[model samples]
Target: MALRSNPTLRQRRLGAELRRMREQAGLGGSQLARALGINPAHVTQMESGKTGISVERLRTIAALCMCVNEPLIEALAEIITDRDKGGWWEEYRGRLAQHFLEMAEIEYGAHGLSTYTMAFIPGLLQTTAYASAVFARGFPRLPPHEVDLRTAFRMKRQHVVRSGKTPYSAYIHEAALRMQFSGPKVQAEQLGSLIEDSERPSISIRVVLFNVDTLPVNHENFTYLEGPIPELDTAQMDSGLDSMLYDAPAHTAQFRSLLKRIDSAALSEEESREFIQSIKKDMERNYG
Candidate 1:
């Protein structure tokens, strides 16, 4: 089979998981290749996601690595056999960075999502006007057409949360609510949208208030996307112009821990709504 010159995030994830398992098992590429009766270079390519592995090969690898987690094994199997191709995000292809497409798939496939942001409402919960205002402030200043495309893309991404099937929990800082990102009207509308979304049974919105005491300096924007199994979980943080997904077990655990700590400092769902409503009223009073 021809080696893939470039692998999508999902494909790369499969390779990464295999590499992790092999490391945990204390086996190197040469050893694995010898045992699997495949060329060592092929093994390298497969582990790096440059080559596709058959379902049989994937299971063989897991068995060799002695991965005892049935759920994780099944999840890996499903990932390899994922034939849905992709949707929506594929359309934007060259128009946006590949990271956006990867993120869309991540958001769409996430069984649930836990997000924490210090300066903005979670994108999945942003209103169209709010999204436009945020996008408009993009660095380098995108053209009008680019901004519109991005807004439309973001709106479609919101469907994942609005679908009401996948649960979403957002821990937004009070500072984010107060930011006049797109001006007071846009900010007010955005806050109102958060309150409205909070009503959905699958959605939980909390505010990390200003008086929550000093938090750890590590608190930054991140979204933990739940995979079918905990081992498949991913932590996403934005980098320059693109997003990065961390699938390592340690990284996943660290992000989950941070989320717990952040959640601990956040207001309860009811309190968050009240907090947001007060902010909205204040915006009307001050910005109007």
Candidate 2:
């Protein structure tokens, strides 16, 4: 099979697991390929997530790895054989960055999400005006039409918040709230929207204050997504140029620990509401 140029995060995760299994079995790609009757390059491709594996081949590989758990093998086989191509982002396939598209797919599939943002409000919670302003600042030379289209795409993704079925929790630093992305008026509106969202049962918003002196210095924006299955839990870290998706146990454990620390340092639900309201009032007093 021709190598897939754009592999999904799920595919990459499965490939990582397969590579770990092979290493644990003390087998090299060439030796494993010989046993499986496939080319070593193909084995490398599958393990690196550049190519997909067939269900039968996946089972055979699992057996060779001494993975006796039928359910685990079946789960791996299912991800390998998955043919679902439906996603809301298909229309913007060539327009947006690959990292944004991947994030959209994973966010849509997640059962729950936890996010920590220190610089700006998370995209899912951003108002259209605020988002547009931020995007415009980043893409200063882009044509007006292109800017509007990108802004609309971002606004459309906000529907994930109101879907009601899935839950999303965000721990935002006080610095993000203080930043005036679109001047005082837009900032006030954004803060009001956050307060409104906090009232929703499925959405939790907390502020991490600078005065609190939190131990973990969260400088990057990161999100932890809980999938329907335990094995599929994933984390995405924003790195400006390109985002990174991690699903290993070690990465997941680190995120879980950070989540605990953030939750502890953040203001309580009631306190968050009051804090946001106070900021909004102050902004109005100074700007209005």
Candidate 3:
């Protein structure tokens, strides 16, 4: 088969795990190639996600590497074999950046998700007006058509949360709640929407106030996507124009720890609802 020119994050992750398995078994690339009956170049391609691996081959790899983690192996198998199923995000593939589609795919497969934001609302929870404002501020400024396209893509991403099957938790700073990307009216509506979302059993919205002594991490926006197995979890960091995904054990662990700390520093769901309500009322009074 023709090798892939651009592999998705999940494909790369599966490849990475395969490489790790080989290393754990103390087998070099050439050595593993001999064991797998493939050339060294083929091994390299597999490890770089430039090629696909069959389930039988994956099983052979696990057996050769002496990997007994059944769940992780199962998860890896799913990743490699599930490529044929195209997601709704595929429709936007040529129009949007690859990261956008990858994010949607990641969210769709996530068992649960947790997000932290300092300056803006989490994308999954943003309203159309608020999202449009946020996108409008992009450097080089987006055309109205592009803004609408991006906004639609973002709203589509929310489907996973709206399905009520995935548990979604967002830890938003007080500053984020106060920032009126468009204006107070839009911000107020966004806050009110947050309150309504919070009432859902699967959605949790927590507010972190400015009074906290210090934050565990810098004021970056990130989302932690929980996979079927902890080892497969991913952390995605977002800057307005770009996003980076990290699946390395250390990085994901650090993100997980930081998110936990943020969770602790945040108000309880009920308290956060009241807090958001207060902010909405303030906006209405001052700018209604």
Q: Tell me the lDDT of model 2 at 63.
A: 84
* Per-residue accuracy of model 1 over 55-153 as CA lDDT, tens digit each: 898888988988887788788888888833677788998898787788898888789999898878888998988888888888999888888998899
Candidate models: Cα lDDT each: 0.86, 0.84, 0.92
Best by TM-score: 3
Any idea what lDDT model 3 has?
0.92
Alpha carbon lDDT at 267, candidate 3: 96
Q: What tens-digit string does per-residue lDDT give for candidate 3 at 176-280?
A: 999988989999999999999999999999999989867877647889999999999999998666888888899998998898788789999999999999999
Q: Which ten residues in a row have the lowest lDDT in candidate 3?
A: 212-221
**What local lDDT score does residue 66 receive in model 2, on the 0 to 100 scale?**
84
Instruction: Give per-residue CA lDDT, model 2, range 72-182, as digits (tens).
Output: 677677676664566888788888877777888788878899999988998899999998887777734667777788788888777777777679999998889988877
- What would the TM-scores of all predictions be? 0.95, 0.90, 0.97
Candidate 2 CA-lDDT value: 0.84
Candidate 1 vs candidate 3, lDDT winner: 3
Top candidate, metric lDDT: 3
> CA lDDT of 182 in candidate 3?
90
**Ranked by lDDT, top first:** 3, 1, 2
